[model samples]
Target: MLNAVIIGCGGRGQIFAEYAKQYPNEMRVFAIAEKRDYLREKMKKEYDIDDKYIFSDYHDLFEKGKIGDVIFIATQDNQHIEPALMALSAGYKNLMVEKPIDRDLKKCILLSKKAKEYGAKLQICHSLRFAPFYRKMKELIDTGVIGEVKHINQTEGVGYFHQAHSYVRGDWANEDKSSPMILAKCCHDMDLLVYLTGSHTARVSSYGLGGFFSEKNAPEGSSARCIDCKISDKCPYNAVRIYEERPNTTGRGAVEKEGFSNLEDAMRKGRYGRCVFRCDNDVVDHQVSNIMFENGATANLTMTAFTKDCNRVTRVMGTYGEIVGSFNDFEIYVKPFLGNDKKYEVEKIESGHGGADTVVVADFLASARGEKEMCTPIDISIESHAMCEAAEISRRTGKSIEIADIMSDKEGALL
Candidate 1:
């Protein structure tokens, strides 16, 4: 059996631990490292991990604990770099790190080089790449059912209320803490597009802003708390009301940390935990990107935080046919238009993205054991990461950015 360790006992860390437990016969969670005292204690009790195996700092886990065969890094967006490097340098042979690698392109490049030089196997957590629905779509496309793809469209409906709670007024509201919305949230989408199209995005154009999630846009005299706000009944972005009606729903807060000392304090302050419109949420709530594939095809992407519902919609168009689908529990639909008539195929999955998390972890484990190839490699992730950064630049500068111009070398491309 391979010994394993998980850093960060927050939500993502917990999920990784659960997966590790599922494969107890193959791997075991031998240690845990977390910064928050409550979370550390919670992990101990929740996972039954011994106190001796817990450390306040992740580096301390690597320094003092027995070296695990593989390390799982699921920390916050801006906090993955040091622990990853430390683990590799400490002689861990395998690593499965969460997506985007790092916010800083230069640092990611340097770490990639170090991993290659040190002979430490690396697997990035682009979970959607392993989603069964997407995998089937890739297979169909490869078999020419989608033909030579000519155009693609991807839409991510980041509900307005959830964006306010988790992004605008929450932990990742600030770019300094997480990253631009493109990098932090939409890297998965960009990477998915690149992976399916099998082409590098030659160029991109973007436009977005902090339109609706700001104090100036809020109704006058409205309290920040949706439960207390006078407009709670009519306002579209009411959280308390929404959650009360849909208890089992997953919000962005579910995926991210809120960073507020208390929910009541946020409501009173009206910035971090308060009313959606009244908070100091400056992150972009809506954005669009147009990408030109190397094969001269184009893909359009839309991200919005002001939707009545939440989900992702995708369509791939080719010379002979087209494949269209949705990821948010909607039925997957494929239409093949071959001049005679249109044929439709619909498949319903058991989980969101059709068990993406399972596939991602299983594939990584197989790759670590040298039993299979990576569905998403460092080089592919680098392309998606750069695309996200460049799209942000385009949105800020109001200009088109060329991928070739930004990354002219293989080293740069891997970043």
Candidate 2:
């Protein structure tokens, strides 16, 4: 069985390690590094790892030298690089770091180049690329049923409550602390768009309303916290309803290490308990990015947090026909200019993120074992990351940003 050392045993790390439980014969968790004492202890007990293999600081874990077949770096957006550099330096040759690799443009490219220099296999965790829903989409597009991919129009419906939970009051609320909404939330889509077109982004022009979720938009009766708000009963984003009454904890600090320290007292005093509109959030509530690919294809991506359900709706237009689908329905429709329309439906999955999370771990394990080629390698990951960084710059400056200016390396279509 392949072995893994989980860095940052938070939500993502825990989810990746879960694959070991599902298929113990294929892989197992050998060690864990986490800042939270509780999380480290939790992983040690669950994985049956010895005390020597658990660390409150990742430095200690890396200082121990390579301990497993691969390392899973699932730290925060800005925290991925240091641990990754440490891992590569420690002689660990295979790694799976979660998406939005880093907010810094140069650092993203640097990490990939460093991995190449070290002859290491690095994969970014853009899990949706492994989702069956998108996989079938790729399969159909690759078959040329839709002809040359020319234009893609996609929308990420960041549902109201979900947006309120994740972007307004959770760990990703601030750009300084985390990442821009585009990179942190929609980098998955950006990467998939690049994958779909089989080309890298050449340029991007983006616009967004960054102040929509601020105190200026708070309702009349909205107080600082849901527990104290007079309109908590009528407010849709009531933290109490989300974290307690209904118990649907998507981002209301389900991971204690993510900052909602105590569930019982959090409703009155914690970050998750704050009113969504009044929180110190700076990410956009609505964003639109117009993109130009190196191969003459174009795409538009829209992300908004006002939809009823959190899902994605995409339409890919080609030379011969067009394809459209909704992730909420877990299906796609292929309509050709002359052929009969076809509908493909994906059955509901038991694993999280529609089973993409577990599938990525499985794929990573096989790639680490040299049984299969890595799907989302470092260069491709950098390409997607550069796209988002350029979009963010455009969103801020009102000028179209060129990926070439952002990436010094002309790898892929960047040339």
Model 2 agreement with the true structure over 20-89: per-residue lDDT tens digits? 8889998889888899887887788888998888889899888889998889999989899999999999
Error of 1 at 215 (Å): 1.4
Q: Candidate 1 regions off by >4 Å?
A: 245-272, 339-353, 409-415
With a 3 Å backbone cut-off (N, CA, C), the pairs that clash in candidate 2 are none
Q: Which regions of candidate 2 fall more than 4 Å away from where they truly are?
A: 245-255, 258-262, 409-415
Model 2, CA-based lDDT? 0.85
Reference-based TM-score, model 2: 0.94
Q: Please give me the total number of clashing residue pairs in predicted model 2.
A: 0
lDDT agreement of model 1 with the native: 0.74
Q: Write the per-residue lDDT of candidate 1 for residues 190-235, one digit (tens) a residue.
A: 9988988888889999999875666777887677576578877777
Each model's lDDT comes to: 0.74, 0.85
